[model samples]
Target: LQQLRSLGQPPRPVTSTACVPRRSKEVPLCPMEQPGETQDAAALPGPTRWPLLGSLLEILWKGGLKKQHDTLAEYHRKYGKIFRMKLGSFDSVHLGSPCLLEALYRTESAHPQRLEIKPWKAYRDYR
Candidate 1:
């Protein structure tokens, strides 16, 4: 470690900067270069959102939790493939397209965790 500093070659700032090994020029990946590439919520489709309650009032008006399925189905019909809505404190984006679901499911193992509740996976696998 001391030898690197002494030789005037400082260690790379971030490991993901490139595919090349030590002493080679770093090739910045697109996402790494422009870090703030997150999807803008304002661009997504959905009903009017109140600051505190978000779209919760709309959900309730449509039929509350009991008819959440119907409300969401209505939302899908109104808002195309993807939409963002907040029910109480949960701010979530719902994807209605099969392609979007496929993409999301493909990345499942990216942050794999132990499944303590077997029924969740069991139900999904059964389908």
Candidate 2:
């Protein structure tokens, strides 16, 4: 380590008076960008919000599950296959194609371990 230190006093800084060119005369932003483009939260839809309670009112009124049957039925009738539904900040993917069943039913030897448990079991245990 001493032998290496003998070879160098860190290189001297070089100073130049050249002014850096501005890209567009706009405010500079960090190169590390956010995941998605920044947008105003007010412009984004939260829920069919009312005056005071915002989305919580609808959720409380429905006892949690949104009345989503109408939208799903409508999409199936119109799209005839697959469609996406936005439900209280969560997404529900609906697949209408017959191939969807085929894909689920077909099994391979190397298929991953399935954690198949009935949904009612959880509710029963909770109760």
Candidate 3:
């Protein structure tokens, strides 16, 4: 309850990393970085991104974050072995191939902190 209450910041909502205002009529404090030469640097194919919100609005349209697992599977079918997604300002690549997974595991740390595994909840509880 305390953790929930402390997260409230009216002027700009507080995310884990940065403060971002909700998608609204108000002008944003910081503009979304226009992908210039950096855009071409990434070679992965993915979802179309709109300015400011990136692919967030599309996620909402597709059925919000709860259905994201299914959505990603659908994307894998559509985009093939690997694809990219931009959520808010964060860009991530999804790997669907076994070879890609094996390659990643080879290069990972001893106790790799990978994304959203079931063990993460247990680890967090242990911590």
Candidate 4:
């Protein structure tokens, strides 16, 4: 079919850098400063980002391991699917929908490399 031929054709690769038009440095482009904002700034929430630790503290404060799983699930329930949460000081996870999580688990795509450890940390180690 014509559509299949089009799909088979090689697509263009994206260039990392493109020439951008230079603008005057004097004029600052503050896109956020617009008139008559309808949205509430505070209520437009993310995963409880703090001053020093950001959401890292929140994740730690909830305890680690299974606790993190529970909290992430809770947040998913409250904030819909695809919610952002911290995992210790170094990691921020954007957890997908329940269906996606299930699919990942079913496909063995969730941290497949973690199984190679001498002593597995998670319950899935038994597999």
Candidate 5:
């Protein structure tokens, strides 16, 4: 098509950054003034996430679902129990410690439900 022809070929070499930008002038990267004070989520260490696809490629590179546990363990050893990961646009935190799990459990409702059940319900309805 004429439109396709008008749009010239892509660049030969694409430039890229190591990680996403943290555009915060007021807040510090890792604020820890008082003793025993917890650091912000942003302050926690994480693997470099590229734009759009984020850390998906990196995760896949290490190995897919089959090796997820091992990959996470490796990351945990490097970045610690709490580290951030971005899969596409969805940002997630990996909490490997018991204390973190306990904190999350305490904050949940008395009868906690699965967050993702729509697909299962839809499949049952279809059946």
Candidate 6:
């Protein structure tokens, strides 16, 4: 009966660690970073992007759908093996190396589910 009655009672007041004062003078950086080295992801170069629309306008300006392969090749030459680009609301990273592709293929699930099947679904419904 006492244990059941305790369940209805409010939680006890707790002291937060944030409220405590630190003895150290220097603040620690992110755990992901080493002492001297910077993050590799931040160093990668890519095209200038606009807010909300991202790099969509820049990609279209290069030649739209007709020259997508050419544009990617141009970017590959400019940005090296790896580059980041955004289209409308979508953001993606492009890898131009065969070794990276092979590694990704080896690591990927055997039965990966396809997310971009709207066109196939539409065709099936129409048929």
Best by TM-score: 5
Per-residue lDDT tens digits for candidate 1, residues 45-70, read 88878888998888888888889889
Worst 10 residues of 3 by lDDT: 32-41
The digit string of per-residue lDDT tens for model 3 on 1-127 reads: 0211122333322232222235432222213322111222155678887777877888888898888778888888998776778888876777786544443343344555546767669999899
Better of 2 and 4 by TM-score: 4
What is the C-alpha local distance difference test score of each model? 0.57, 0.37, 0.56, 0.41, 0.58, 0.55
lDDT: which candidate is best? 5
Q: Candidate 4, clashing residue pairs?
A: none
Which ten contiguous residues of candidate 2 have the minimum total lDDT?
24-33
* Backbone clash count, each prediction separately: 0, 0, 0, 0, 0, 0
RMSD list, candidates in order: 12.4, 21.6, 16.9, 16.2, 17.7, 17.5
What ranges in model 1 sit over 4 Å off? 1-39, 107-109, 112-127
- Please provide, for model 5 over 11-115, each residue's C-alpha lDDT reduced to its tens digit, 9 standing for 90 to 100: 122122222124421221122332123455565678888999878888888988678788889999998777888879977777776544543443344455544
3 against 4, candidate with superior lDDT: 3
Q: Name the regions of candidate 2 deviating beyond 4 angstroms.
A: 1-67, 104-127
Model 6: per-residue lDDT, tens digit, 11-107? 2222232422254222112223332233344355788768888777877898987887899899989988767787777766677865434323433
Which residue pairs clash in candidate 1? none
- TM-score per candidate, chains pooled: 0.54, 0.30, 0.53, 0.37, 0.55, 0.53
Q: Write the per-residue lDDT of candidate 4 for residues 17-121, one digit (tens) a residue.
A: 121114321111112323212232233335776656667666667885559777676777776544444334533334344433432233333234332435554
Q: Considering lDDT, where higher is better, how would the candidates rank from best to worst?
A: 5, 1, 3, 6, 4, 2
Pairs in steric clash, model 3: none
- Backbone clash pairs for candidate 2 read none
